[model samples]
Structures are given as C-alpha cells and as structure tokens.
Target: MALALNDKVLTEVYGPSTGTALRIKQVAMVVLGIAVLAIAAKIKVPVPGSPVAMNMGTFAVLTIGAAYGPRLGLTTILGYMIVGMLGFDIFQSSTADLNGINYMMGSTGGYLVGYVLATLALGFAARAGWDRSMGKMALAMLLGNVIIYLPGVAWLGVLYGFDQPILQWGLTPFLIGDALKLALAALLLPAIWKLVGDARK
Candidate 1:
C-alpha cells in the first residue's frame, strides 16, 4: 500500500515522533538543508554553450523536498532564501561581494521562486508516496523540474525581452544536466526507501 496511512515521510521515519525532540530535529534539519543548498549552489560547472553554469542546487532542492515533505521542505527552502537574502554566499550566482536583494532580483530570481513551488509539489507528491517507487519518483521529479523551468524561463523572457532566445538561454542548456539529476533522484529516492524498509526488518 501507499505510505501505510500514517503520513510518514523519509525524515519522520527515523526522526522523533513529538515533543521538544521533534522540534529540535526539525530545526536541525532546516539548518542542514540550508548548508546542503549552499554547498550545491557553489558546486557549479560551466555549461559549454550557456551563460548560466549547471549547479547541483536543483538536485539538492528536489531531494530535500522529497525527503523532508511539504512543510519542512518549505521551511528549509525559505530558510535558505532568507540566508541568501541576508547577504550570504548561498545561491547559485551570489557571492560575498555581489549578494543580497539586488542579486536575488537579477536574472536567476525566477528560478529561485520556482524552487519554492517545486519543493511544495515534490513534497506533497512524496507525502502521497510517489517517492516510494522508481518510476513514480522519476515522474514526480520530472514534474518538479517542469515547475521549476516554467517560472525560470518566463522570468528570463521578462527580464531580457521576449525577443531574446530565452529558451536557449535558460532552458535548453540545462536539459541534459536536469535529466541526469532527475535520473539520480529517481534512483536515489527509491533506493533510500529500500534501505529504510530493510533497516526496520
């Protein structure tokens, strides 16, 4: 069956049930999630024909969303953005010298917004047990990417004029990278579920 009707998520499977311990776990998870997002953002590789580099940030974002579920996922993502807004070098294109509000309002702003949307999408999907199977998880990840790309491409078109090759600039270059990340997430999530299952046996 799906999720066993308990509403349990990956994090909750191994986490405390309630009380101060649960609160502490959630807060600590948010902190760790922020750290993961920051590290992923910085680990960028230049795309050969694209202005934007391919980064692991999306992968981390989707994984976090699936693992943490909607509420914690949203909290973690918001916290990450808050950290970036506070002038931290924790976004894909931000740095110590060129961070904060102005930087967030730049070209990549739409994708940042998309991260929140995709997280909720994936989180809800995971809570519904989509993350339990490889095929379903892959589909869920694909949906999340589409959610991310729509706003991202739209923002690029708006920011740089629709006359510009917005799809070429913001979409196509990352398709290959995103595909790889999607496959990784698909495989990784199901595999983790297996581990979780096996651990209890």
Candidate 2:
C-alpha cells in the first residue's frame, strides 16, 4: 500500500532514469497539470446564489495528484493556485472573471482553497499506491472530495454568516456532480494505468 519514492504512475510508465531526466519530466508534468486544470476550470455550470460553480476542477485535481504522486503533485497544485492569484484567469468562470486578491475574497475562494487541500490529500493517497487499483482510487477520490468540501463549507459559512446556510451556498448543490466525477476518476485512473502497461509490453 506504500509507493516507493519512484513508484508513481508516470515513473512506472516511463521507467526510472537519471535524476536529471526525472527532474525534467517532473517539471514538464507539473506544467501540463497546471494547463489541464486551467482548462477544467473553464468547464462549469453556474449555481444560483452560491458563488461556487460546478466545474471539473476537482476531477483534474485528483487525477493530477494520482498521476504525479505527492511531491510533484503538491508542487503543481500550489503552482496552479499561485498563478491564479497572480491574475491568470486560471479559475472557473466565477473566479476567472475576477481579478487579483478579489477572487480569493469571492464566494468561490473557499472552494479554491479546498482544491489545494484536496489535491494534497489525494496526492498522499496516490503516494500510498492507491492509484494502482480502481476501488482504492475511488475511496481516495471520495476522501479527497471531502477534504475539498470541508474547508469550502467552513469558509462559505464564515463569509456569508447566518444569512445563508452553508449547505445551500456550498455543499448541497454539488454532491451528485462530485459523485459522478469520482466514479469517472475511479475508472479513468486504472484505465490509464492499463494503457501504460500495454504500451510497455
């Protein structure tokens, strides 16, 4: 259940190489993860009253983490967040349309923050080799979603206060979508692994 330092999906697919080569590949993967996340952020459905948009961002988060493993995955997540903070329009429409620190102060900020935590939680799970199988990855993805939602709900509750219920503003609207995303991820990760396996043979 533990991933050796080099036991990540990409590492498995490509096989081990010199430290320099690995470093180069890791950097490239991080950049690619950021790009994919930016694209995922754009695919969204606006939820009324609530600042949080339903987006594929979470799916990209867990998928990237599972692919990149803990260390590189964390680097990529933090990079994505920071770049958005620098006004890259990297967030979903709700926040991407926003500028500077204002977006973080927006209703969607908590969820964005949740993306960071969720990526870490799932990345760690990936480091534990959870990505190698569908069931374990499903659990890892569900847990990752929880990690995203908790801070999201808390931040939403604090920002809006008692004026709106946190569930309405943040949590309740996205449950089904998140479930669907999780199921898709469960299948996707193992399929990618299988493809990689087939390629190497």
Candidate 3:
C-alpha cells in the first residue's frame, strides 16, 4: 500500500521552500486554480435531448480540490464564482446576455453553488489522505462529482418542474461524462504524485 502523501500538491511538488516564496506560490496556485476552473467551464458539449450541457467544470473542481487543501480549495472556488458573478464569462453556462448576477439567479445557479460544496467535500477528503491511492482517490472523486448534481437537479427541477423527466434531463444524461471525468481525475492525481515524487528524488 502506498503511504499517504501530503494533502497539498504544490507543497509536495516544490519541496519545503519557505516564507514569502511559499505564500506567493500558494496565492499563485489559487489564481491558477480559478483560471483552470474557468478553462474547464469553457469546454462545453451540448448534450442532445437535454437542456443541460456536459462540461468539464466539475472535473476541474475535483482536480483543484485534490491539489489544494480545503481552505485554499474553498477559497479558490469562491473566487471563481465571484469572478463569474462579476460578469466574467468564466461560468460554463455563461451567456452573451446574462453574464453577471443574472446568471447566478438563472437556471445553473444551484450547480454553481454546488461547486463550492463539491470543492469542500473533495478538498476535505484529499486532505484526509483519500488522494494518495487510486481506489481512495476514485471514491473521493466519485462522491464529489455526485454531490454536484444535488443542487444542479434541484435548481433545474424548480426552474423547470418537479417531475421525473426534468430530473432525467438535468442529471441522468451527464452520469457517463461524470464517470469518465472521475476516472480520469482519479488516475491523473496518482500519476502526478508519482511523477512529482520521482522527479524530486
């Protein structure tokens, strides 16, 4: 069995560089994380027969959560949301007309909210040693991915209707994509850790 690595990927990758350098690195990581989330959100695929699109935002969320610890991960996600709310086209569901607070109150707002929860959930798990091995990382990613749909489906259902069809439209269509993303993230983290550890030695 592999021993648990440190929860924060930056700290692990860069060695124990201290003081202002570490703080700068952490701040840069948070900003980069937000940029990553935005980039992932932009990779949108229109799902046929559903209003909800398949996007890699959750995948990025999982990756960032696993890399950053809870506090930093949560802060990073919140920063992403704030950026979106401030009229940036950083959100996956961003529209030409509705870019600011309007988008938040729009249909995809709940999933937007769920992003924070997913980050916190996965962040906590990563910090607690779930990010070390493939099996545990996969489980943590799966849980994190699933929780995103709670608010997603709820908000979607409320905006549309409280019916099975609506639920299916909001969630069922994305399960396969989410599973693939989860598996990718699970494998990706371990691979990154292995590569980084080897490089440092």
Clashing pairs in 1: none
Q: Which 10 residues in a row give candidate 2 its minimum summed lDDT?
A: 2-11
Alpha-carbon runs more than 4 Å astray in model 1: 1-6, 198-201
In model 3, where do residues sit more than 4 Å from their true spots? Answer: 1-12, 15-17, 198-201
Q: TM-score: which candidate is best? A: 1
Model 3, residue 183: displacement in angstroms?
0.7
Which candidate model has the greater lDDT, 2 or 3? 3
Candidate 2 per-residue C-alpha lDDT over 14-101 given as tens digits, one digit per residue, 9 for 90 to 100: 8454688777887888889899999998999988877778999999998888877777788999999888889888878634457557
lDDT of 3 by residue, 75-192 (tens): 9999998888889988887877879899887777888888899999887787766776899999999888778888988888788788657767778889888889999999988877
Task: Give candidate 2's error at residue 118 in angstroms.
Answer: 1.4
lDDT (10s digit) by residue, model 1, range 16-85 = 7699999999999999999999999999988765556789989999999999999999999999999899
lDDT of each: 0.89, 0.81, 0.82
In terms of TM-score, which candidate is stronger, 1 or 3? 1
Provide the TM-score for each candidate, comma-separated.
0.94, 0.88, 0.89
Index of the highest-lDDT prediction: 1
